[model samples]
Target: MSTHLNDGSLTPLYQQLMEEIKVGILNNEYVPGEKILSEMELSELYHVSRITVRRAIEELCTEGYLVKQQGKGTFVNPRKMSRKIEQIGDVMGFSEACRACGMVPGAKVLTVQRCPVRADEKRFFSLDSEENVLYLQRVRTADGEPIMIENSFFPYNAFKSLNPNELNDASLFKYLKNTFGRTPTSTSQTTLEIVRASTELATYLDIITGDPLFYMNAYFLDQNKEPLLIGRQYIVGSRFVFNF
Candidate 1:
């Protein structure tokens, strides 16, 4: 509401402008996907220099509160999806987490094939070097918005009966539980890190190349403590949050 910036304040002009714009977004003054005022207009309105306005906008974009489109303008970003990391005994899948957040979960199967097992996969599943594994890649969505890319591997001999067609827009965990009587109850190991989106990943997740993403590698175990599968997920940083 207040367009005037106080030069007397200790905060830098750019930071002050950033906070004001953030407040506008939170207050719905700037709706998601709505193009915001140009830097020149913002500078004129706030009585600040163009450099100050540019810095504020840049920071907001980096923080995921805004997005800049080439030739177009800056727009407000959609709210981030959230997932909680609970105790070891409590594990939640993407679909379950989306449902809990009151969003419709969907998946688009990207790739399904049998691939030679990597050394790590062989060790995790206690398989021989000659064994192969069923690999599945999918783009997961919440309410029709692409959120993450899921790369999962299952022991071919045990889950060779899996139907790839059934995976589209379906819950893999639920399917495994009902069809194979195998429920993923826990994760033996999980590692989290940040990664830049590749061109292919950018296309899949509908994000810009080099955008930040959260990469997770997890080894899952069934209810009976049997090795189940390995998951490698690349989540859109601007559209997802991890609650620990």
Candidate 2:
């Protein structure tokens, strides 16, 4: 790697530095989400002034190639995955969305157990006071990159046969469809909000604590309009895009 910059070139020093950094990113010299050299280190390595290094870093950030976390250093930005949110009839799962964006989808089951029904779960599942609900938590990924934390709830009696071991790296939607003949076709209700990541969520999504996340609550229904499941997802804000 040539770090020497031409002082005689007509191109500004900052632009030259920017190009070099961009090339480094393109060549996998700086992997996604990996922190880059500090301003002083970059200045020394590129033989440029601190101002020049700062300007280059700023431009890279503006171009979406880098991101600056408060008090933490600048890091490479992951490629944002885009999902189209249409009417309730056009619901898409995370795996389908990832494939549409030319990325591989992955999931790691974090927790699976039968838990006492919450108020909302009872209301959605029409469960009695004594009934419990099946709770499942997973770290959803795209191309080996952690993207979201998925917390899903299902009627315990209806899904008690689910094998926790099979959920690792498997699509719950597909499993429900194939095993129980229950297909989630549309969402009956959906809401989106912004929330700060808790420590556990940050660890799961590989983000800093208090980072912004897109919190989504959705009630899913089968084709016959029968309720199937409820989903509460916390997605990394900088790594996802939603089109309405």
Candidate 3:
């Protein structure tokens, strides 16, 4: 760490400290919610002034990388949020991914409601007058670990008598195949802007609010190219990472 910093480098000493700490967190050397060393300890450890350490910590806190308790020292921020990007046109369900990864898939159904489709959804799904929609919200987990929060709207009649609780450990695609003899052969997904985790979402996922998170909107289609499911997923960046 010392080799990366130069006294004559255009960067300030505090900035160097912040960059090193940031890298440490990303590399998992410093974990989220883990207390950092105190000012005096950091000063001694880095051979820097206490003021420099304080400034460095303050900048990190303001940038949402660290949290400071009134009486306690600062702590590394919680895990980075994540999303898994499937190959284009590949069809799989949330539970299948968890199962394949050797993790048990779990879900907590938050709400079930019959509602008219929103305007944006209408255009996206090309809704017909005959199609009735049901809104489903569930927090998906793996091996009892919170991973994603799903907000979806499906055609009610296609999944008639479906209870959200019964979806545990069952892939949505598999259910479609078994119950309705339908399956999604392909899908289109779009990732939106990165955003800070919300209080409710963070609480559900056991992370601090304002943590980094990824947002995704996906459209699933059946073998016949008919829309099967349209949904949005809020992924926990820390729990999962993807290459594409």
Candidate 4:
């Protein structure tokens, strides 16, 4: 560690300290919720001033890489969340991804209604604007912690028989295949954007308005290449690092 941190290097000593501590935390050298060494101890360990160590810790806290308790020193954040579903896109639903990460997954169905497609949705589905569709608004959780808001739109005929109550704690992917004999064979397109959370999204995601969140729009196709559904998800960024 001393060999990598240089006094004459372009990077400030505090920045160097931040990087060093971040690596330790990310590598589990300092496990989540574990208190890091005190500033004086870090100063002695790194052969730097206490102020430098304090500054590093402060920056890490502000970045969501660490958290500080008033009288408890600083601790590694437990919410270094990661979800990687595929190479280019997270084709798997949120529940599956969370389970793969060793976290219990759950969902709360917020809204279920059959409604007419809006103009943009009609264009994407290649349907008449007056045609109705099945829409669902859901909140996804990992280990019972709310994580994202999922808004999905599907053609009515394909899922007309689906019971909204069945989705309270269910996986949409599994339900579709088991009940409708529908399987997603391919992803036609997906878009990613970094945006501040809207009020509604922030409320469901348990984040403050204007906080950074990931906005994703995905289009899935069935075996015959027929459009299956379109979904938009707002994922909180501070608690997650999207793997795919």
Question: Of the candidates shown, which would achieve the greatest TM-score relative to the real structure?
Answer: 4
**Top of the candidates by lDDT:** 1
What's the lDDT for candidate 2? 0.89
Give model 1's TM-score versus the native structure.
0.77
Candidate 3 local Cα displacement, residue 199, angstroms: 9.4
Tens-place lDDT digits, model 2, residues 15-103: 99999888887666877889899999999998999999999999999877899999999999875788876347788888888999899
Worst 10 residues of 3 by lDDT: 79-88
- Show the lowest summed lDDT stretch of 10 residues, model 4: 84-93
Cα error, residue 210 of model 1, in Å, equals 2.2
Candidate 1 global lDDT: 0.91
- Lowest lDDT sum, 10 consecutive residues, model 1, at 78-87
Between 3 and 4, whose TM-score is larger? 4
Cα lDDT tens digits for candidate 1, 172-200: 99999989999888899999999999999
CA lDDT of every candidate: 0.91, 0.89, 0.76, 0.81
| lDDT per residue (tens digit) for residues 143-235 in model 4 | 888888888899876677778788987888888888888866567888788999888788888889999988888888766777888888888
Residue 230's lDDT within candidate 2 is 94
Q: Candidate 3 lDDT, tens digit per residue, 39-110?
A: 898888777789988999999988778989888778987654332465556755777767666678888888
TM-score of 3: 0.69
- List TM-scores for all candidates, in order: 0.77, 0.72, 0.69, 0.92
